[model samples]
Target: MSTMTVRMNEQDAELVRKFAQFEGVTISDFARTAILEKIEDSYDLQELREAIAQDSGERFSIDEVLTELD
Candidate 1:
């Protein structure tokens, strides 16, 4: 196990502490779990940014999205 230090604003640090307490975990454990969970859910950033850059705001509704899907 490795120990690392990170800096955050007081408000953000307090928020983390509150959430950790609510979840019955140490701040470190809560942060580590949150980080790992997000990484697991994420897609490659390069592909996401490329898709976003090409988006033209042309498809703005559920119907349009369904049309494209079908």
Candidate 2:
């Protein structure tokens, strides 16, 4: 495990502490989860954008697919 430190204003720190307490998690755990989730969301968005850019704009429906299979 590695330890990292972050600097924040007292008001922001207090808000994080209170919110963590309210959520029944330690400040460290809250911060870790939030940061990791943000990273995951960013990665997912980038992948979506790339997929859209590469898309061929083909159209299909479930009924059409089933008919083709029959």
Candidate 3:
């Protein structure tokens, strides 16, 4: 694995350290998880926007589906 360095103000760094300790994880692990989660959230939001844009605005209800099936 490659090592990465992050630069932050001392106050922010202390906050990260404290949060990591509170969560029982190392600072690196905490940062890695936080970064990956942020990326995943952004990807999901983009997908949702694309899906909404492509949507046809069709309406459906479970009862209608069941009636149609019958």
- Against the true structure, whose lDDT is highest? 2
Q: How far does residue 56 in candidate 2 sit from its true spot (Å)? A: 1.0
- Candidate 3 per-residue lDDT over residues 12-66, each given as its tens digit: 9999999999999999999999999999999999999999999999988999999
Candidate 1 lDDT, 1-70, residue by residue in tens: 9998979999999999999999999999998998888786675666788899999977568988888899
Write model 2 residue lDDT over 29-66, tens digit each, in one string.
99999999999999999999999999999989999999
Candidate 2 overall Cα lDDT vs. reference?
Answer: 0.99
Give the C-alpha miss distance for residue 19 in model 2, angstroms: 0.9
The count of residue-pair clashes in candidate 2 stands at 0
lDDT of 3: 0.98
**Over 4 Å off, model 1:** 43-70
C-alpha local distance difference test of each model:
0.88, 0.99, 0.98
Error of 3 at 29 (Å): 0.6
**Which regions in candidate 3 have their CA more than 4 angstroms from the true location?**
65-70
What overall lDDT, based on C-alpha atoms, would model 1 receive against the true structure?
A: 0.88
Q: Every model's Cα RMSD, please? A: 5.2, 2.0, 2.1
